[model samples]
Target: MLAHLRSNPSLLKLDLYCKGIQLDDSCLVTDDGGRPILRTRAGLGSGLEAILPGGLWTNVPVTEPFAQHSPYTLHRFTSGTYWIHWQGEPVTEVALSPRPAWYDATLPNGKEMTHIGTLQGTYLGIYQAKVCEYWTAKPEKTNCKFCSVGLNLGVDDADEKSVEEVMTVVRRAREESGITYVDFNTGHYDGDTYLDILEPYILRIKEELGLLVGVQTPPHRDLKRYDGLREMGVNRVSFCFEIFDPKLFREICPGKHEEYGLDYYLEAIRYCAGLASKGPRHEPWVTNGEIIAGLEPPESSIAAIDWITSVGAVPTVCVFRPLVHTDLEDWAPPKTEEMVPVFRRLYEACMERGLPIGCAPNVHVSLVMLPEECAGLSKKRYPWQRLKLEAKKRMFKYAFERRLQTLERRVA
Candidate 1:
């Protein structure tokens, strides 16, 4: 098992999520040109971003209490090199996720570029709206127990972002970072206004930049709003129903349980998954039913993955990180052994269903292991299916890049 982990970068990433790394005295993150640790929206990632062997980008936890006891430690040498040492033995050399120049640049309105959005792996991630209504509800708050969205707003992310400001940052990310995808995430609102708040930004990104755009927000009260999103060129829609066990779901995500029941989330996922064949054929569409693994039993998480894939929607399984100051702050993260089966199912379920996993270009996520990235965890192999996916990847990349170039020339 140890040998396999050392050999496979994706497994290393999964283990790092469960057992975070400790920083050595020789380590100097930003001083050595590393990206600063900022608690962005949702606050799931608050760590140093580094690329492991085999080009796997990851956010390694350093500030959390569990990380302080980890056997893994990151070391920076006097010659300006970084290596990960496990039990005082070197495991693999790592590279810092590059700090884009625009991270230091400011907008015309004097807002910092990073305040609008930040890179998650190679793609741009913007927390599109204000704090979730659950966090701001009067008398008492009912936000997700494991989330830090309320705690992060107005700190790392700006309280509000204009569509024009977002477009400027999106253009810069594409031009400089070579990002082909942009993801916008939002929390609950009073009037199901999250979709209304996001459509303008999505339209501009599609019309002007011609990049792949995704929306991760609460399921709207009106399911038909998704049809309009598809026609508007939204390539992906993700609903984060963070726990699968019905009873636990209510306890963990009180606001979600109260506002839109778990059944509604599943229904929306099914509804949106069916929209794949109805939209513009040039635009690839995917529906993700996201869940946090550590918040529930391994069997429950696997069940969620199975149900999601059964419906032609992919499962995005996230390792529950007990971020500081959140309601679940004292909870322990799931063990890697317990999570291996969950992630293995994640890959197998998607492959068995012939879902389009890992087709996006330059989209390597740092917060969670993508389904395709979990291929290493499973012993099962699907050679024919793998071949079909490769062909699709090449075709999609070519078409998408050609569209971007044509748009750029037209604007020029």
Candidate 2:
């Protein structure tokens, strides 16, 4: 049931992304207790991710999936009553990722804390210095045709956020929403400008809040810079080599291909894991290779899963979302049925390797099911493995509940 919810986000949501928490209309979908849920479009375009109860992560459609019809809709009972129904039956109780208590927090600079970083899934996302050189560069030669990262410039958040503004939100989110990580995304600005600009923010986040940091950027010309990032306590690194097929990768991500090539991304992550393994600090997974599952043939995704896991990196597979107003707006995404087998293969590959699967629930985003959750479908698990998995699941639940409990000041 959880997997279905994660797979079929368009089945329930009326909108593709969350309308900002500042708007009461964002409450079109909310919990039974009458708290606003997050499933409306955000930013300049309609791409967004949402986390469901029990840590299930899903990519929501920006528009209606079925052209003004779907089996699922929110059924309101009494004034404070709500339930998610599919095909006229209440399948299960559902809730949205709530507005974090610090959404309205004000920074010392007078800018609202949320205006600096938007809450995405469980982590806060800061698209600091939103300019991407590729978008401005020769259009035909650069710019990933599928990406809208640069399209968001000046639409909502600032082009550049100061360290202090980001710090205010991080601290408040930790206290209020219990966010454990900050995922910083950037486009190459002035030849390695992305990391150079992001480094200070990373350093402050580590020294001030002791938060885990994840970076998504094109690989630096010098792969050794990854060691520098690890030394500064970056928890994870991801490269969006969106497709496994080389020709398609080069075509879709012309900037990444022409600038650094796929080898740069693969080697950088392999090196990150190796450096962390030999270093004093170690976490479950140090590197992630992000692949859009439906962008290429399912076979390409499965092959990518095999290769990425083989090289000490986990594959963060996203279902392809054809956003409105992007170059690929008219493109259609694969059906949910097509993705089940692809994700199932992904789950098996990770389990076969015994890679540490899920991040701590507090920090893990639900854009897709973590390897640990997908491992549930494995019928051939060893008895001991099942016991260990159960124990870990309990641990995550208990840890997450502890954070939620803090919200109930009445209990304490």
Q: Where in model 1 is the C-alpha error above 4 Å?
A: none
Per-residue lDDT, model 2, residue 342, is 69
Q: Write the per-residue lDDT of candidate 1 for residues 1-412, one digit (tens) a residue.
A: 5576679887899999998999999988887778888885766788889998877888988788989998899999888999998888888889999888999999998999999999998999999878999998878798999889888887788888998999999989988999999999999999999999999999989999999999999999899999999999899999999998999999999999999999999999999999999979899999999999999999999999999999999998889888999988898989999999999999999999999999998899888899988888888889999999999999999999899889989999
Clashes of 2: 7
TM-score to true structure, per model: 0.98, 0.81
lDDT of each: 0.91, 0.63
Give me the runs in candidate 2 sitting further than 4 Å from their true place. 1-27, 30-53, 62-69, 79-81, 139-141, 282-285, 359-361, 382-412
Candidate 2 lDDT, tens digit per residue, 211-294?
Answer: 668898878878888777877778778887888899999888888888888887788767765764754343223788888866
| Candidate 2 structure, TM-score to reference | 0.81
Top of the candidates by lDDT: 1
**Alpha carbon lDDT at 12, candidate 1:** 92
